[model samples]
Target: MGNRVFVVGVGMTKFEKPGAREWDYPDMAREAGTKALEDAGIDYRQVEQAYVGYVYGESTSGQRAVYELGLTGIPIVNVNNNCSTGSTALYLATQAVKSGQADCTLALGFEKMQAGSLGTIYDDREQPMMRHLLALAELQEFAMPPAPYMFGAAGKEHMERYGTTEEQFAKIGVKNHKHSLNNPYAQFQDEYTLEEILASKRIYGPLTKLQCSPTSDGSGAVIVASEAFVDKHGLADQAVEIVGQAMVTDMESTFADRSAISLVGADMTRVAARKVYEQAGISATDVDVIELHDCFSTNELLTYEALGLCPEGDGGKLVDAGATTYGGQWVVNPSGGLISKGHPLGATGLAQCSELTWQLRGTADARQVSAAATTSGVALQHNIGLGGAVVVTAYRPANR
Candidate 1:
């Protein structure tokens, strides 16, 4: 890396259910991109490149989105990494600055998804998740949506191995929903009691409808710059440094073992998080706030162990002890997470970035993590895709 990359600004739109609004992806993109630029106090002409992420779109959707900012003629690269697409775009933008390819780059992601459980758009082509489906069949089978079963099976395995309970998983939904009450951008902000969560219609295994992320339409963006660019623009007061970031894909362990936990990306998350800790010279205990992928409450629980927030298979105990919330070890998902905040596949990761940046800047007024706000604290992020990929990143305010 030739230069240290810092995020100078971040922005996102309120996450809404699919087709709930009149706006299209381009409109969403423009709203988010403009906010990021405005936050950075820069013009589109200053941006040297763009990396846009989306899963369902026509060719050059990135180009169309960028045009909403300006036809600056900078190179625009489109990225698709399943659910990890947003963070993958962020990774590319950070690299473009770190490698001295550009002083400033924009990472933007948006999605306009269809209602209901996700389905294949290209049924005639080779499906990327076929192998994953095969692995699922080996473990347990379900008649409902494929995603819930994958993560739900992981939760079931954790229960069998470590005595985790259905109530424990339901608590995650309760917590996130409570947190979302403070986030205006979240799609679902109504808090539910544990009993309500448990009583909601079951999707798969112990998972309930309240425990899963809904199909969402939204956009988020971040403006990243090199140290030199920040200095030149006098943006030192607001810059957040990317202390460390790492991405990992599936390994032999994903398939070699029949465990549903590993099959649903536990190993990949563990590896990526370890790499991030190594790069940042920090431990899981150092993190004060987290915005992890909570596509399902089960995944959130699985991730606690994967990220070493607790001993392996003790994720249920971790949450039950109040260790993953505001007054505990860390404030996980102060933004309400995917379960309550909504998961726009292409935009979820950047939304995490946006929330963390605000928290670091002491601007997350309603949902601020108190201890983290009081000190020079670390924020941890985890975004995963099941085909599979995981990105773990560490952030700190630049002055810290």
Candidate 2:
């Protein structure tokens, strides 16, 4: 791999249906890819590799969108890692540029599930081995199936194991929504409170509907360049470098073996972040803004400890102290996260990259920070795949 890879540009559409009608994959891909190209001040001709992530775009996936940029047979690749699809593409793009395989690469992720159904979730009997295991568990535990709501059970287990409360989970909601209020592209731009969150209808145990990320369909893209390429193109003067990256996969069958809330591959998040920080010679306290994978409100809490932002069981403390807020010492999820910003499956990771790119570039408009801006300020993103596959990354300004 090359010495370094940098994010030259990033783009994302509003985290909602584009018009009166809902959204479709092709349109969103075009919207996001064009925006990224514009932001990078470069033409699609510069992109040598394209990695498009989509969950259910059906026929003609990544290639169709890159074709929007005047197809030049740019070795396009498609990736689908459940919810972590976008991040997977991003990881690959970075590797491509780092390995000298491509000087410039594009990673785009988009989806269109707002129209109605969830598009297409393979329910075939001839699925992976993990499918059979989960099915048997569901048959045994009839009432409480281990689906996306496992996060809720994890929340309950957190409280049971560490005396955390529903109100504390609500605290994370209040903080993130407040941060979202400043993000123009965020879906829900308002401040919520613990009381209000508790008052809302419950989805699973203590998890209210508002606390859960809705099934949002959206699109986002990120452009990466090699350090040599950036220097040649004068892009290093304005780019976000990748300081760290790490991906870990755990046992997919999360039935009786693992604890629901005991931190799934959490050690991986820390290890990855630490590696980047050590390589870049920076610490967690050095980061001024962040985009976290908050598919469930409970996740935000766990990430704090996992990322070493705060001590274990101190997630509530970090949020309550106003540390994760904009004016606070360090900001987390200024983009509203999957909770308020909308989780467009494959697009989530790219969205995080877009947000951090804007932030480090000091182009965040209303949400910009005035901190001791590391010309290469850090932007961390975490994305988890089916059950437990996760990939976390940290980005810095390309120039730096």
Candidate number achieving the greatest TM-score relative to the actual structure = 1
Query: What local lDDT score does residue 240 receive in model 1, on the 0 to 100 scale?
Result: 94
Off by over 4 Å in 2: 17-23, 114-120, 126-148, 251-257, 262-265
Per-residue CA lDDT of candidate 1, range 312-365, in tens? 978888988999888898999999999999999899999999999999888999
Residue-level lDDT for 55 in candidate 1: 94
Tens-digit per-residue lDDT, 1-400, candidate 2:
3568888888888887434345567788888999999888999988999999987666658887667666787788988887888999999999998888889999999876644323335777554435533543343332232333556766766677777778878877877777788887777787877788889887775688778777776789999988788888888766888878877765443444455553344555656667767766777887778788888788778777778788877777776787887678778887788888888888999998888888888888777765525664677777876545678887777656
- Residue pairs with backbone atoms closer than 3 Å in model 1 (clashes): none
lDDT: which candidate is best?
1
lDDT of 2: 0.76
TM-score of decoy 1 = 0.99
